[model samples]
Target chain A: MLKANNKVLVTISAIVLFFLIAPLIMVIITAFGTDATIAFPIHGFTLHWFANVFAQPDFVAGFKMSLIIALAASLLALVIGVPLVYALTRYNVHHQAWFQTLFLSPTFIPEIVIGFALYQGLVITVQLPLLLTLLIGHFLLCLPYVVRLVTASMVLMDEHIEEAAWVYGSSRLKAFLTVTIPNIRASLVAAFMLCFINSFNNIPISLFLNGPDLSMLPTAILNYLQNNYDPTVSAISVLLMLFTAAMMLLVEKGLGLKALNEM
Target chain B: MKNRSAFLLLLPGVLAICLFLFFPLLQTIWPTLGGSGYSHFLHSGYNRNVLGRTLLIAVITTALALGLGLPLALWIARQKASVKSLLSVVILFPILTNAVVRNFTWIIILGKDGVLNKVLLGLHLTQHPVTLLYTNAAIVIGSVYLFLPIMVTSLIGSVDELNIEVEEAAAVLGAKPWTTLTKVIIPQLTTGILTGSILVFAGAMTAYTTPQLLGGNRHLVMSTLIYQQAMTLGDWNQASVVAVVLIIMTVIVMGLMRLVTRWLDRRPANA
Candidate 1:
């Protein structure tokens, strides 16, 4: 019976791993295969598709825009979010739950509603520029996550460390800057990466926010796939998967995999 | 200390969220306040069918995730610590990449002449490549792939907290593994099962990219239908109507899920 259970467990593990890993292998293999058609057992191998990803103007332009948006949004999320974490965690506040809800509400709501809401309010009503609009929109989308991670790090700390800093002739701000901030450096980096990935890969918000004039990379790929089907997308998918895997690697080295589980 | 500086620090993020996230949601909801949009959405049998279909898909996706997730969770629970951590990464792939990239994987996996079909054909299991893409089956498969991680994550969270001694006790008492699983393990999985199913259902229902890429016209989940009515037909009212209905449905499902969890939590005492 125990042997049978072990066999069952091993089989389930194999299937689960295969299910997760196969699509990536398929995309990677298709990207390298010489055929424009994606079929198994490649007869020839080529690097043409990787070059095609660079050659396409939309892919290039979208890549640039996505990079800009993701960077700006994540950076701004850290700036705005970290301070909120400090205030919420340290300072006494009235209606704490209300404040928490305001901060975290973006996540609990569906992305579609947020996207639709932003479309109406920002583009239609407020009439903001697309660049600024998407930045602010993604900032909102990523703020809750940033706060969660940052606050979690703070909570894990010895609460009296900051107080001890005060006893040692350090001001609250001085203590926070010197002791509190340094302690949570891992969480800060993790939060930034979390926000960056969220903003970088976001589609629902991008779907509504993407105008005729400007598009994010995911949205661009989506629009590309609507009219065209080719191995070019396969190549782009491979590149993106690699890029994110690389970023996750960086995060893993810096903070560890535990940071992502919090997300 | 709490007077000027902390307030200032909190001001920027708080203001941004309220201005960008909250007020905009209000704007989206405001236009639908009038009964006209609701009337059009409610009275339309076509839209009703879409709602039914969306709920059906969401439920089916939840069921599939539950079926796959429970066993995987159990297996992981039995593993060594290092193996468990490494194994968890496989499940995290769905979230590690963009949803679009992940959905594109389905094209290569489930497409006609795709890898799975090719393998099947090569093995002489079938003479022709099975048509998997552009069907409801394909969409369900895509959704399960997309949301499978959530189920696994929630289950792992709960499984790690589960008391292993109970299983050992059952074994010592002559209860078979299967008997212990149904009578002992599953009952305690109330929290994991509830959290996983609720998240999977909500995710599958609102999923736009995966359905669009894999499902094509064969399946129109709630999110896709909203995108179509708004973008394709240029009918914002109808789109907002569908969006509102989707939100209501999600909330209702979540409420129902909470009730189920509460009921499950109460059950062991009675037994």
Candidate 2:
């Protein structure tokens, strides 16, 4: 009876997984289905729609912009977040917990709020450039994630290693650069991957920040969907999924998906 | 390191949040303070209804996510090491993809001649293609899909840590399986449940792509309404007010979640 109950549990969970991934699988299939429009019973499979995705200028530009913004934001996140985590962990900061809470608070707060605030605040109040606003919004989004990843790595490292370097006449800065950073290189790389993918796939932030001249890939796809019902968007989505999936596979391999699971 | 140097090291991140996050957030609501936007939210039945609907959808999505995700978590927790890793990867896969792609996939699922309708019709459950797309139901489906992964990921480690010996103890003590689950297992999972629910509920309430793609003009959630207000009508004041209302509600929910988690943590001692 116990064995039977366990079997039932597994089967039900598998069904739940099936339901969860069903849409993703459908996107892949629909991308290869008949072009122009989607119907229930897809006719002969073809890659015509996939080809049509690249033919659109908006999508191409959006893809490039997403790439640039994600890379820029991730790089910025690392530059800022590495030292932030280092300070919080290594130095005696008053109310370190409060600082940690404040940084990670972004992930808790709704992105819609963030987007709206940036739209009015950056565009209207600060008069920043459009691209800069988008990058800044993404940097905020990526910063907490970077801090969390690096902090996890920091918690596991032996303090003796850094202390040894310090005893050998290494300055705190030199010891950190030589002893600390190299030890947590994997976590840093994982953090960069996570931040890059997150910024790349973001919508709410991009929705408010995206101007007429500057649209990210996800926002552009949405625009296409608004104008057209063709499976072209589906095709582009499949490609995006493939790209993200490849990156996720890399993260899982290197970081063991622990970086993702924590958040 | 000097405390001052440590503060300096933290300054860049603090500056980024202040410059980009807090300052922007304050500015978005600042204009609405002297305007009719506040009254509009208070008196506007239409706006309140939209807000209520957003809350309702979020609640249902949270409930469904818990219902579905718990089982998945339970099973994953019980899996062997190898199966556990593969299943973990598969479970986390949807969240890694772009929001538009996931929402677009939902559009296909809920479309008129789409996957669900096709199955329903072929199965003879419905004589005609039920209008599933562009409805609140579609929004619920999409939100649930969007948030379910987060719930499962949150629950996995907590459930895995649960002492099965206690469950077996209950079962051996003449407790039914349902009783064991309800009495023994669930009480311990309060932390995970609270964390996941807050994340999902907050997420569903503020979701953009899923609702925009699935809930068209006919159905207006708070997020889409804010978009329409700001982008379509260029009414930044009203949008700001709506943004403030949404933020207030989010803060309340987060506060309530913290309270509930604390209550849960403290409850067992009294028992």
Top candidate on DockQ is 2
lDDT of 1 by residue, A1-263 (tens): 12225676668766876776777787788777777776656658888888988998888999999999999999988888888888888888778768886787776667877787788888889997777888888887788888899988887988799999999999888998999989999899888888888889998887888876688999999888778667888889889988887987887788778778887
Best TM-score among the predictions, by candidate number: 2
The sequence of per-residue lDDT tens digits that candidate 2 reaches over residues B1-271 is 3888899999998988777788888787777888787987879898988999999999999999999999889888877888888888887788888888888887887888788888998899999999999999999988988889999998987897888888778878888766777788888787898889888998899888888899899789888988999989998888888888888888898888878877877876536
The pairs that clash in candidate 1 are none
Error of 1 at A186 (Å): 1.9
Model 1 agreement with the true structure over B196-261: per-residue lDDT tens digits: 888898888888888899878757878888888888899887787787777777778767876888
Show pairs that collide, candidate 2. Answer: none
Where model 2 places Cα greater than 4 Å from the true spot, the runs are A1-8, B262-271
**Model 2 residue A97 distance off true place after TM-score fit, in angstroms:** 2.3
Docking class of 1: medium
Q: lDDT for each of the candidates?
A: 0.82, 0.86
For model 2, residues A1-263, the per-residue Cα lDDT tens digits are: 12224766768787889888877887888777775696545788899998898899999999999999999999999999999999999888899989998888777667877887888888877799989999998998999889898998898999899999989999988999999999999889888988998899998988888777899988888888998888897788889888978998788778678767766
By summed lDDT, the worst window of 10 consecutive residues in model 1 chain B runs over B262-271
